[model samples]
Target: MNQGDKWTYFLGCYPLYSHDADDNRMFRIITSQLIDAGLCRQIEILNTFGVSKSSVARSLRKYRADGIEAFFQPRKTRKGGRVLTEDVLTKAQTLLDQGFTSGNVADELHVKRDTLRKAINDGRLSTKALPPEYTTKSCRTTIDAEAAKNMGTACTRPEERIVAAFGVCDGAPVRFEPCIDIPKGGVLCALPVLLMNGLLNGAERFFGTLSGYYRTFHIIILVAFMALCRIKTVEQLRGHAPGEFGKLLGLDRIPEVRCLRSKLRELGSDADIIKQWSAYLSKYWMDQDPQAAGTLYVDGHVRVYHGGLTKLPRKFVSRQRLCLRGTNDFWVNDATGRPFFVVDKTVNPGMLAVLEQDIVPRLLKDVPNQAYDKDLIADPFLSRFVMVFDREGYSPQFFKKMWKEHRISCITYHKFPDDAWPEEWFKEQKVTMPSGEVVTMQLAEMGSFIGHKKSGLWVREVRKLTNSRHQTSLVSTAYDMEYQKLASCMFSRWCQENFFGYMMHHFAIDLLAEYGTEQLPAGEEVVNPAWRQLVRERSSLQNKHRYRKVKFAELTLSEPDANDENAYNVWFSLKSSLLEELEHYEHELEGVKERIKSTPKHIAWEELSEEDQFQRLSPGRKQLMDTIRMIAYRAETAMAGLMKGPTIDTPAARRILQDLFITEADILPDTNAKILTVRVHKASRPAVNRALSLLFKRLNNSEVIYPGTDMQIFYELGGEGHPQNAGKGVTQTSPK
Candidate 1:
């Protein structure tokens, strides 16, 4: 059809019937062509020649249902057409049957070229036996009768039958299948088994406490493991053989490559989900068991880099990192050897605020109010009553402030000149090491430092020790306490260092890689500059200046908003209400009549200023503000406790948890209780919930606790003996 005619015809279809008269005319012509064909006749015949009113209606219904193209279109023909003369037909059939060319038949017939072509073009002829190139080649193989007979016999040969059974159509001989079986007790599976056992009952019962986001986090880690240890390329993930990975995960079906790629791309862009998942997992690790009141270790570390790459926007940094920088910070539970919260940032004032105002509050919320009884361990960077500072964090004023605030009971070690202490307190004293070695010492004790001049409770302890390697002075908050036995606290510090190592060596490696490089071709840079220059001169000077000013304004003040309107507002409102209640209580005064009447005009004016006059003042305003502030602070602290960024915690802690909890089921014995294993290609809230549901259904169990390595033992031992075996203290298998 011509373009206009086609358009007209197209418009005549449903939803476009309102088009001009030209479209209706095209539709009529198309319908007329359908009527001319036998399709209309067949419809009329089926409806008894449309004589009966019902029959006419049926015929019309059939006509409309079939559409114009279906009624008028000819039947589709096969490759070759009809044969003309018997001889030409015979020749074509013989060649095709014997695997010869159609062109060969045309040449052998020695007739006008169009004669064979016409026969082939007709519907009577078939070219099913011809190869794809038969129409182009003139050469034909003459069949040998004896050879054809032999070939027919060869098709039935036992070897050929065996080849067919194996699905090998080619003529090559088949090789025997290998019978070797590898033992399953190798190191490859041990690590995951061990991790699973630890996760179930040892300390962190991760499975039982897993949240939606935490589940997603685990899935992401699983994907990372797969990428690192199983399949390496995106293409491989897409086109992977189902049998191979299916056997590994015990899956009935394998995910497509597109699904995995889509998941990875989604996770890369979704920082919010990552943050939520990180927090959820941290909480899960911390609250694994109620009996275990875990000690959380907080510290900071640096992620150094060359200055070529642009940094991520400040808002993208985790809330934990926004408070603390320079030194990486993490919250580790010493009881479980699990690092839950971590953050990394450059050294800056904003980062420090995040640590004190954000991270600490959240962590403390997870910790019961009574948890203050247990000292929070940190380097000198974190100033607490019981502060531990290395050479870099040494500050006398910091200790004094902590003492005044009654925030902590601390132990810090220092070294300085003898004159730093008072002469009377420097009298002979002795300290003993765990190895039974004794050293005479003089301690320089301090009553008060600069900031705590009035309180006078701050004290410094100093000692002099002589050794073959070096003779020097030692200082500490743990005055005359023995030195060597404090190794447990020292070892705790080592765990923090290990966490730092993991962040740098594992998680940060990939993140830094993604940010540091330009993925586009070098030529694109040259083209980009030209395009920018071309657009630069198009606008008016005033407009350009205004745009520049606006852009600069955005960049300079682009930090995360103090009160983000779009954040979880329900929680915010709840906090605001609580503050309002607290303010109401604070403003309540007994016998207010006298104070109100006797108050001076200036004092009354000051009271009015203190009131929120900009907004309509409420009677309970003071109590309300107090309550809301307290609630908001508590909630913020709770959330902060759960949040852990990739920068703070090392991959080692995650690795240890994974090793203690996750394991393969192939080597274990089967049981009536279904063993559910889900391989989520994508890690996210939805994926995690779906996986949990599937696992729950498959196991026929109500609750599926995570990091539950004990499940492996139950799975292995089977039946009533399973729970008993756990009671007997079974050793955990290491994860592969």
Candidate 2:
């Protein structure tokens, strides 16, 4: 209601207060009180009364600070003045005379550049140009160098940290500039293969772009190069020239270790996203080579943790022959040992559990060219795909279940085999291995029942008799496959093992990517410490009981000659004592067994007592790094495949690739033509140089574009008598 220019406000028809419109101070005080009393909301006041939000906020802040009297307090006025005080001007003039720029002087004196320039223009200050030796250009950053080279002004293009500081640019596109003798320039040769293997596939979608100088693409390529160059850890980056390495990335320099780690932390904030990226890449790889996907090799590699931050569960590290605290990574690789994906388990449930629960489901979905439903029904022996692993996955029940439920086959070393077959049963047969090597082997096959007689499953058991007359037995549910192929496939499981060893030695696969630990999820189940202790106790008692029983039985108690009654009495006493101890241990073992049966084998993480609890190593960053390394390994493998010939075998080809990665080369960037020419220098050996030149030709044929750039990569050999110019009076071979 309004009366004589005064307005009254009401809530639910109850009068709140009345005041004239011109009485701004009273209005502010009452409005603040209404909001403070919860009679109205700030938004409601602004919306219903068409008042500015700042006005309402200011009124509330003033009232809250000084109560209602604050609205009537005197209004404050600004006290503005020239910031260039006499003392500040004196210091600025001195800095100007000492070769500092006007902008620098303004920054040093905390004054505006325009104000400083005005002072100079008024003749109040004088400036001097520094000698060429003292100029800032003498110390050029990567950004400044790129700018001088006409490669644009953005620092680490597509993502400029400098401009991004002011929120003007989101990312700077990747650009290249010409350079001479860039160290490790040969790493660019693998870029095509890395891209082919989907190194950056789904990266932007999953990780988004990092907000600073290093974009997702740069970090990934840098990491891949580091892996290829044998730079195992981020800390190793400090030992190398950042500017030199930055050339490989087409940047001024790779980010500092701390900057890289922050970028990694931001990219790996979510573990699920990393897994999704890995899965996407895995599908791409499988889809690219469906033949390799037909048979997958599954195995577990333990990454031991020596850190004292958290107490991880102990796993038997077969390589070290000792139980160690670590996590297990179950890798699914193709027959040739190229990785498809990996599943990490901090609380390992064993190979069988992982295959059935984590691995098989993924294989069933990802394994391409599964037999049609009608085709599967038409042929009883038909199977969708085969899984090969070590003996740890040998389970007759699992084999039967996979065949019956999923129509999937399994090949693994038999956990238990009968005595060797007759010598004449084995015949020498030539087998073609996955590596295209044919070898003669004494092989034989027979149908055998595994497990109990009544519930056992019939499987094809193939055995190979070595030159030493030792039989290597293998079990397979693939009934229709020939014994020769089964033998080759089973033996090829070593490819995966070799993959692990090579990665551990060269790629540092077992190293911890990060040292952070996180608490395990509440419902995550781990082995129960109490149950494990009870089992250990029972085992100790059983061993003691067995020893005592042996002692008691060995006491023959032969009747001593009638003349040696003392000897007979001593023997009887010892035998009686042994029997008594055996009986005691037997009783104790029974009690312990009963307790073990009563205790739960696995308990949730939250159920454990404080002292028994532990956090698991952070998997997010490790998983990301592992994926990049996997890509790097695959790329190297692909290049090695191209380099293999009569002179260069797989091992030699890989060695050449490693050397090529660290070899110096000249980089010629043709911006107009959009081509990046990496001229690799010749190797010490003429044979290796010829092989590298051939490899480069093959890579150029693919015409793979550099990631994050439009430039097509062109690789060639440098130095005299290069293979490309061999016809021009240049010998292909160089003498020592």
Please provide, for model 2 over 1-736, each residue's C-alpha lDDT reduced to its tens digit, 9 standing for 90 to 100: 5576897988888887989978877888889999999988999888777889999999999888999877767755323336776777789877876545787678777888888887777767888843443212224355545654553432334336567656676544565666667778889888888888888778888998788566788888889999999999999988876766787777766777888888888888899999999999998898999999998999999999999999999999999999999999999998888999999989999999999999899888887788999999999999999899999998888899999999999999988889988989899999999888899999998998898776579999999999899999999999778889999999989999899999999999899888899998768999999999998998888888888887777886454565788988988889889888988998898899889899999999999999999999998889899999999999999999998887778998999999999998877666666667787888998899889878888887776666666667778777321122211111111111
| Candidate 2 collision pairs | 157-172, 158-171, 158-172, 158-173, 159-172
Worst 10 residues of 1 by lDDT: 176-185
User: How high is each candidate's TM-score?
Assistant: 0.36, 0.77
For candidate 1, write residues 190-282 as lDDT tens digits.
Answer: 223223312222222222222211122233333433422323344555443332232233221123455444434444343344444445544
State which candidate has the highest TM-score.
2
TM-score of 1: 0.36
RMSD over all Cα atoms, model 1: 30.0
